[model samples]
Target: MSTTTLTPKITMAQAINTALRDAMTADDRVVVFGEDVGPLGGVFRVTDGLTASFGEDRCFDTPLAESGIVGMAIGMAMNGMRPVIEMQFDAFAFPAFEQIVSHVAKMANRTRGKVRLPMVIRVPYAGGVGGVEHHCDSSEAYYAHTPGLLVVTPATNADAYGLLRAAIDSPDPVIFLEPKKQYFSKEEVDVTAPVPPIGRAVVRREGRDATLITYGPSVPVALAAAEQAAAEGRDVGVVDVRSIVPFDDETVCAAVRATGRAVVVAEAPGFASVASEIAARVTERCFHHLEAPVRRVTGFDIPFPAPKLERHQLPGVDRILDAVDDLQWEES
Candidate 1:
């Protein structure tokens, strides 16, 4: 007799919810709170069923004040509590910039390690969700540029579960950027399974012609571009950059060196953005092995546009493919 063990399939949002539930169950110190996170279950419903499962004391709601919410989390962290707070949307987090950069990001160093903030700031980020202004934004570059903060963004459902669990358990503060567009994307996931430690980049596809390095919302676009390139007789690889800060130099450089060509993709603008940093690193580390200058396919340098116009602002498959083609290729 043959038996089939079926693995449950779930969306990224559900996977994240499962992670939160598990974390709260394991540790009494793990508390979750933010705007509408309690009774409303969050805007994307990623925190759904938390209040019922963990109760109001562990998973409650906060006011609309982003700064106050983060400030409270910092105080809670300093007092030995692990607070996982949410910023309802990407641009909505800007109001808490002072609190994040001033206190949350610098508290440990300022205290000479006497106080550690084991906190996770979850920001639902990136475009392609047709959200109005202040609803969608690619703000990873801002947090990644700051020191003393671990910045990570997951592109897959399995990662959505694992990364959040790791972030909650971390001793330092972590900026967890969730790709808003991928929240509903489903896949088979085992929430209890082990995952790679934070800061490791995973190669999604293998190719010899060129490589597409990307993260978050742009990851799917990069993979689709790779598939299209394969149809055109051009083999292309893809690297999913799960962690922004503490970048995986070894893995990223290795993939670029193997292909000898690379294009960095992101929904953020190219000017001095995360995509720019990746392109620079690839160029510097893989210079001798590179056949052409690193290219970037990124969102235009402008404010997050209206919902109807986000398509042009977010990186897409065609733009990524064009960047791949720009990589100088020798005649076959």
Candidate 2:
């Protein structure tokens, strides 16, 4: 469905806020908690004034510990409370790893599918915000490796609302990663609309020559690169794998089969990254359609550096276009 044409005053962040407010109003069982979520209104103000609006009983703040934040949410979920826990930053999620991996991820299966945890862990992720080392990270692979947890990322404001709505409303646990940089970026979204199913990828743009596959934060960059490639008379396909964990292999393989060439893009480090996984699977599934070795233009292998050096490290449209140029396809 397309975004409804309304006054363009709302931003992507506002769309998220709208969804959270709606959810709390719709379901009394839905409780919001996190560090500074009430008085300070969260670091980015995503949860601004929510406590006052919804009352402290449902919307409240927690201690500084992530383990405490998540572990308590697990108990609340088991006891039949839908807790929406927010991680202050992307990298801050590591400390809560034990509770998530040990309890939250295995509870339903450990109970022989009789019990489940209906909790949503919201994390603001990725760089481009000039954050310190442990703040901006595309840690999708970490949670994706853990089974029984639904992992998702939104590239657009509309998907942000739909996916978060579906996530909170679902019966399973969901790890929702939001690109910190895109938090303030404006996008058209109709909050009155219904959302699509979770764990499905959307083909953002169509191309015949090559595919530029990507997801959160980097999707807009891929679209910009595709525009430049089009100006040079090259067809570039851009696919948004909105659902990262339950990756949409059918759509991805279909695009690669048609294009015969693929280049994966992401803000994460180059080594052992999501780009690597996608290239491997695409090569395996679309071997016959291959024209040249699939490539990836991603962040440098080194740690995410200071703001000035980060530009050189992060993959830009020029680099993606360069990957497209470097390929020497035989049949295409």
The best candidate in terms of lDDT: 1
lDDT of 1 by residue, 163-225 (tens): 999999999999999998889988888664775588899999998989899998888888999
Model 2 spans > 4 angstroms off: 1-7
Error of 1 at 317 (Å): 1.0
For model 1, the superposed segments whose C-alpha errors exceed 4 Å read 1-7
Model 2 residue 32 distance off true place after TM-score fit, in angstroms: 0.8
How high is the CA lDDT of each candidate model?
A: 0.90, 0.88
- In model 2, where is the ten-residue run with the lowest total lDDT? 1-10
How do the predictions measure up, each by TM-score? Answer: 0.97, 0.96
In candidate 1, list every pair of residues with a backbone clash.
Answer: none
- Candidate 2: give the clashing pairs: none
